[model samples]
Target: MADYSEASPPPKNRQIVLLLSFFVGLTIALFLSVDLMVGVLIGWIPPGVERQLGALIVPAFEQQAAPSSAQDTLNQLLDRLKPHLSAEQQQRDYKVLYVPDETVNALAIPGDRIILYRGLIEQAESENELMMVLGHELGHFAHRDHLRQLGRGLLMQITISSLFGDISGIQSIALSAAQTIGNSRFSQNQEYKADEMGVTLLQKIYGQVAGATDFFARLSEKKDLPIDFLTTHPNPGKRVQRLEKLIQQNGWTVGDRSPVAESLKMP
Candidate 1:
């Protein structure tokens, strides 16, 4: 009688399967560790090194930015918010580069620069709202969210390239770093923390948190609008809820909102 016995799998096939599983597990572990490592390593990175990384990325935005009254208005707002920052953050010369593009977005890049697009300005109905937005970006700087967005891998590459004085490697890494930042998204917790910081600064500067959630509340109402800010940021509705809660929890009062300056208003 023919014996019906299950045959063992081929050794080669089993080896390949195990090897693939090993690599997959290793990849998952690395990814999970990167964020934790980045959090620890970021605090150690000096502002000077950050500027070097920014040197590679800021030029692209700088070339796109034009000097205008709008830009001047933005920097003035940033200057007003500067004193509210910690002494360490105040040491860096923070400025705004207002881009004429109507992309409806703002960015806190490596170079202590806030890239504010005209589209975002057009969305603002009040000076307080704009100041809150500016304050929000400063919060990113204070928390080093910009660097955190770059990931530990690219950060390591940049640091190593800089240390070794590898000009060519550094140049290549710069492009990667810029692309990573452009496409990256901040975590919801990070956004909430930044919002809290913005609210605190708004209260300190204007003595009330008026317009703290106005910009976000407005954006949340216009769901049909194709705003780029919504893409990289958390849902506007959620942010509005969180900010409102923060204000109430702290017993902060909401006062009148200052009107946006004519020069800064989008046509």
Candidate 2:
């Protein structure tokens, strides 16, 4: 038969190659599906719905939060910063509120709200430091991070409900996951962008970069810094170093500047 058996292909080897290729293609498709799901979770919500969601959530938050007693002084700082922002930034009515917490924290809520905690204000060594904190919150708003975060929380709730099918068993787990999502860290890129915006705000307000790194320098000394680094923010040491580099690059002086408004008291 002219060696017909030798002419046949290696069927076992061909099957193995086909099996490997199938798995590779399946892996790629799975990754693409995950990427699409993440996009929908974070950015797919409509602006109107996002605003309505914010409006609804604000009331619940207000019930739990104590208003700032230093509103008048904080308002003065807002006025000064307002006149310097671009018209686009001015278009949105940004409002600031003070929360009565002792933790050094601040939050940028949806619907043009910035929650400034008293502890953060007390931690400020200068008005510039406080201004930088305000600027960072504004940066979060300008980038729509607040809305994105809210959307993610909502999506998580939907996903958990859909996956579990039974409400009673999974309700607690779903709630816990949603809370974690709400408090989760923004990507490193977002943090750096906020830092850049804060620096730009300082330059616009004061003709230099003074006090840009002051608060971060102090923050770096805390024992909880390592824990904080793994969570929401970059390490304070890295932030200070980056700010210092920015100052040197712009040839800005790190000199003493104007203090907080007289009406405001530190601590």
Q: What tens-digit string does per-residue lDDT give for candidate 1 at 15-133?
A: 99999999999999998887778876786666767787788889988999989998998899889988888998889989999999878888899988899988888988899999988
lDDT of 2 at 56: 48
Full-model lDDT, candidate 2 = 0.67
Count of backbone clashes, every candidate in sequence: 0, 0
Query: How does candidate 1 fare on TM-score?
Result: 0.85
* CA lDDT scores, all candidates in order: 0.85, 0.67
Q: Write the per-residue lDDT of candidate 2 for residues 42-135, one digit (tens) a residue.
A: 5544444444445645554466566554765665676667766667678777777766666567777755667676777777767888888878
lDDT of 1 at 67: 94
TM-score of each: 0.85, 0.72
Model 2, which residues run further than 4 Å from truth? Answer: 1-46, 151-182, 224-230
